[model samples]
Target: MSTTTSNHIGRKISRIRELRGMKQETLAEAMGISQQSISQIEQSETVEDEKLEKVAEALGVTKEGIKNFSEEAVFNIIGNTVTNNDNAAFFNNYPTFNPLEKLMEAVEENKKLYERLLKAEQEKNTYLEKLLSK
Candidate 1:
């Protein structure tokens, strides 16, 4: 079992399962494995080749498709083209962003701004109506 892309593979599996709208229980049953096993596999730090093949079959995808499946692969593939210093610059420019935190903040800010704008629009409309009536 190689640990190189265990997390990556697990994420890919989860994404594929979600895309197919298949529950973890369903996938576990189809693969003849326990639900816990499926969960562990999806969260595993390293996965066996046989297990990978089984997962690919169950997902109706190729092993390479699962193994090579990620935007991170783009970084990994371009690794040789970057030096230590160059890579440091890249990471500095685009530090890893947490999805949940960033999204939550954006949503809250958008809600506040949207409410403010709507209120202002309502006030403007009321003032315009009064002026036009007069």
Candidate 2:
């Protein structure tokens, strides 16, 4: 740990965005902001609570997750999981369950949501067609 306390919220956001495989432009679109604005936010040391909440939502992470972000913890989790190292170097980084399982769950949930959306669109088209015929 560094002697200086590091509580840079912007860095955390940027790191999480990168790890999520999201482009700055993608995040900007999600937040309804410009890519330049996203760049500015990343440079900021502190962001307002409301903005932070929006950013967290756009990143698909909780506000607390952004607040508590740590590169070391992330590294520990990845290293341990891949190497099957039983050593728990960090308490917070300790996996409560399988990460891969959670990822699969997220994928399945997204698939269901897409199906629901597609169905809704099809129903909407049918309704519009009936109105046109009348």
Evaluated with lDDT, which candidate comes out highest?
2
- Local error of candidate 2 at residue 20 (angstroms): 0.6
Task: Predict model 1's lDDT versus the native.
Answer: 0.81
The segments of candidate 1 whose C-alpha lies over 4 angstroms from its true place after superposition are 1-7, 71-134
Task: Encode model 1's per-residue lDDT on 69-90: one tens digit a residue.
Answer: 7645645667866778556755
lDDT tens readout by residue for model 2, 66-114: 9988888887778867643554443447688999999999999999999
lDDT of the candidates, in the order given? 0.81, 0.88
Model 2, stretches more than 4 Å misplaced?
Answer: 1-5, 84-134
TM-score of each candidate structure, all chains considered together: 0.47, 0.58
What's the alpha carbon RMSD for model 1?
12.2
| Residue 47, candidate 2: C-alpha displacement in angstroms | 0.4
